[model samples]
Target chain A: MQIPKPYLLFLGDVRDALAVKMARGILTWRPEACVGQLRLDDQTPSLGIDDLPLEAGRERGAQTLVVGTANAGGKLPEHWVDTLEQAIELGYNVASGMHQRLAAIPRLADAAKRQGVKLFDIRHDAPALEVGNGKRRSGRRVLSVGLDCAVGKMFSALALEAELKSRGEKADFRATGQSGILIQGEGIAVDAVVADFISGAAEYISPANDADHWDLVEGQGSLFHPSYAGVSLGLLHGAQPDFLVMCHELGRPHVRHLPHIQLPSYAACVERNLANARTTNPDVVLAGFSINTSNVDEAQARAHLAEIEAEFGVPATDPVRFGVGPLIDHLIERTR
Target chain B: MQIPKPYLLFLGDVRDALAVKMARGILTWRPEACVGQLRLDDQTPSLGIDDLPLEAGRERGAQTLVVGTANAGGKLPEHWVDTLEQAIELGYNVASGMHQRLAAIPRLADAAKRQGVKLFDIRHDAPALEVGNGKRRSGRRVLSVGLDCAVGKMFSALALEAELKSRGEKADFRATGQSGILIQGEGIAVDAVVADFISGAAEYISPANDADHWDLVEGQGSLFHPSYAGVSLGLLHGAQPDFLVMCHELGRPHVRHLPHIQLPSYAACVERNLANARTTNPDVVLAGFSINTSNVDEAQARAHLAEIEAEFGVPATDPVRFGVGPLIDHLIERTR
Candidate 1:
């Protein structure tokens, strides 16, 4: 779904930095789309942008009010309904990344309807999709698969897009999750879709483009992750990536949420992903490694990267700490 | 969702045998549960059961009227509404395996509500599920995985369940699809569940039981099928089978519905399924091959089964044409 922008990011009394991750991502990557930040109180965390009132933000050309901060239960706080209704009354479309739907609240829904404004529920909003056809689409795709959840798959994909664009190559960052969708203003939350349509939604996310164009598809859960591997596999097949970049977090002891399950080795992760990806794109190949080296110091991170590159014979780098230049270079060289 | 037995199977003017597959499945596997049949017209294929009216079937102890036929688009035919309402008015819970919701039809929904009967859309009914925790639970489990869609995974699972029970072993067939759900009377259609809950629903389907008990979990979609691999993977992780049976149909040249995509080799399918299945149950092993030999002569089917058994060093049989005794023997021996 294409969320209207420029957006006034709503951080409703959220004190934790993690709660405002969606807002932070949008500001960091698409700062130009973010008109201003709107907070419920002074205690709320700042996105380092102007804390403009709804009227002020709308006057500044904010077309949408984005509820980017998540609450404890991912629900829209009852107290925040007044502010959302007022924003809708001001002729601004409202968007949310919360688990709950904004349209489900009668006050906000009625206000939006009266003002002819739209409510975009990023997690719940998706176009009707067909099952994955496994047809070979004409475009180069690079997907970031991980060894587990929250391994910087989205960050790596954004980096890949930025790097490709800097080199004057055609590239687009295709988001598959809530935060990424808010950042890019368009994407399907494949995880929230009905199970059978996972791959179909992924295919819709990155459709056929110019052969030289690259769609950097952000990945989700890992193949080794018992809870979410199905989503990962469906996305992998639908994307039909020409190149894959394995994303891993340094020093992860176990699979996320499940303490008893240990992470698979990098070799196992890469081999399995490639084997599954080959179902749609037979010529698919591993391009590089995108490591999350936040747990290690610069020297250790650099050394680890060097070791991985030497062992796997592919470029390795922390996309957040360093850059995705090496990965992009490898992708370009491999394609050539 | 527990569909109350005994069911009066509804075949709505469907002349094609394929359309009545669900009715046939229920009749074949759970004949005791099938009280009678109700057809709108004489042209509809019969299940060789008593053809009774709604009131007559209810009087005969049928608690549910199961719409077990599929129309061209899986929609409930507008003309079939009167029959469904009549069943509801006669105190029969209406259960449908159609893509459309039974509760969506106002006349049927109102009738069921007024009659205090339930409308169960088999493909849409699911309990709220948590994400699969990937924890080891008690009870031995066997899953039927396949090389492609409709390759007899459910039939193999049912056969395995039947064979195990015939040996006086404790076993239950866990259904994961529409037809399987109708036959078994309870299950979550994993494919129709929200993507995030596929595995969670699966775990719920076959919960912890006695250590000697076997939950013969029916599988869906092939890991190599582009449209459905995600559902397959999620189900695999959720089922956490200690042993797996590979289901394949002979003479199938390509993946179902996607003729352009060739099927993966038997070795590849087995290796991939085992590798993925190991994410949840690390000790998972291939117990046997369940081949659909309807396309071949008895001699050819027997010869192919023998060749497969010798190659894989696992029991192989056509569960339908031949018995699943060899497969069950292998399972029993391996577990011991």
Candidate 2:
């Protein structure tokens, strides 16, 4: 049997903790497929633009579990026409942040297809773990961390939490940090800034405590939105987790504009997040990044969901944590 | 005749407007000497234990300006350690904004001799031009855009205004932009930020139809102080100007640990006040920076004045704008 290739990826600054967990997970899945992440700071004078071909060069068949990919088709400056062209020549798949509102999709897609890159939409591929499996959550408790409007994380966290709880097991949901600085332009650096996430978690569950299974949520608004990014790192670094459950924006958002919660595009977020965790040795990691919703009450939102599912295989119903349930039960069975 | 090498040179984050003016002035005056400016962004990521050595490699062999070099040296991790060693090995003189502080003198002398990089003290430099240079108040009036406590700009503007007024010439000084928001994290788009600096002279003399130059007198407390490096680039950028001036700090109370302002160094004053003809981009430019007052009284002030004259080879005297005399008459002659 041919060994399946794993991909590595991450988002934003590599220093982010969740990204670190995801990278470690990729390495765990296929140590040989390990690939790191890359990010360029705005302060650096333009590294004079890359001349590399995007898709073709990316598909060089390194068996990459790339932590993430580059955002080749981003807000390219007019003078960087050469750089944009180089991105097309590399044969890397293009994944936009938002589907409908994305102005660069057509151009990027044309470039990707022309180069024969396998562009997968994460939304459509995310069927909940129980969608086909008869067995429900075997027995496990999940610990989740989320920030922002807490809508996407809330839904995702609840689904996993409920699945486990229905099995007569315990699962906990924790929301911390509001990404208030993104819209409000105010900053406060303290544990209390996230409404005492550590303290509250300490009260609910001790770090030294163990369960049949344990999962920690990473990634969301706090990872990238500047003021909150550092706080998120601090939280995760202190937790010293058993496993990392990384949630990503796979396909696109259900809304036209992502507001403050724009997901990373294509290899950009993945590569960076992956690089962040290359050093941290986590045991098991399951990751997902996509948006899907069912029975949409909002028309535009519903349309966005459909578009994302078609484009990135990531919709609300699709579980980003592909084999997460099975993996959780496996751990639970062993621990119990 | 062989051109003489500059006994001193300035290193600084010339990307910062005021710092650039001061650092660049040293080069402009002695263009024959190899003068290289380095930009040490405060936000560069650290590698290993040290930062990536973003500016480490840029250290040149010539007189090192090392403006705000303190930002680089510290207990950085190992990666940064190697980078710093590389810089020192490459023979780049390192210095910091603290050169005007008493503690920096020894470092300055040592770095100068060892690295062949005369770390020039910005505050010690003087505005190259006298207050009055008897040319019609060229182009638009001079509105020295600066931070609120731009005590340097304030003093420069007052001195320039007095010169222009005494010489029967006309000009104005204005403060622009009520606040500095561009410096805020992710609040304003980078491209549109430059629009903030379109007016300053008019803000002073023509702030309102009824406003006079005296009306433009704003206390330093009113200016924005995000990091309080003592110089506010947002203010300079916002008040896009006819001519810009700043007060560079020199060691003494004339300033010892001066108040923090725009850039948050001991040089809370503009290291140099530069006057450019923005209209046609005239080749002739006027530049100025301040000296700290060591004066305990008339005798001491005069004694210090003689010392400055001997050091810089320029006719040194207490500011006539802050006084009244033949010096004031010369200023009027220069500006009018």
Query: Highest TM-score among the candidates is held by which one?
Result: 1
Candidate 2 interface RMSD after superposing interface residues:
21.1
Give lDDT tens digits, candidate 2, residues B208-255.
221122221211211122211111222222222333332332332221
Candidate 1 ranges beyond 4 A from true positions: none
DockQ of each: 0.92, 0.01
Q: For each candidate, what is the lDDT?
A: 0.92, 0.31
In model 2, how large is the Cα lDDT of residue B11? 31
Model 1, range A25-131, lDDT digits (tens) per residue? Answer: 99999999998998888988898999999999999999999988877887877788888988898899999888888999888888888999899998899999999
What's the lDDT of the predicted structure labeled candidate 1? 0.92
Residue B18 lDDT (model 1):
91
Q: What is model 1's DockQ versus the real complex?
A: 0.92
Give the per-residue lDDT digits (tens) of candidate 2, residues A147-229.
Answer: 22233443455455545666766554333221211111111212222211222222222233334544333223333322233
Q: Is the docking of candidate 1 incorrect, acceptable, medium or high quality?
A: high
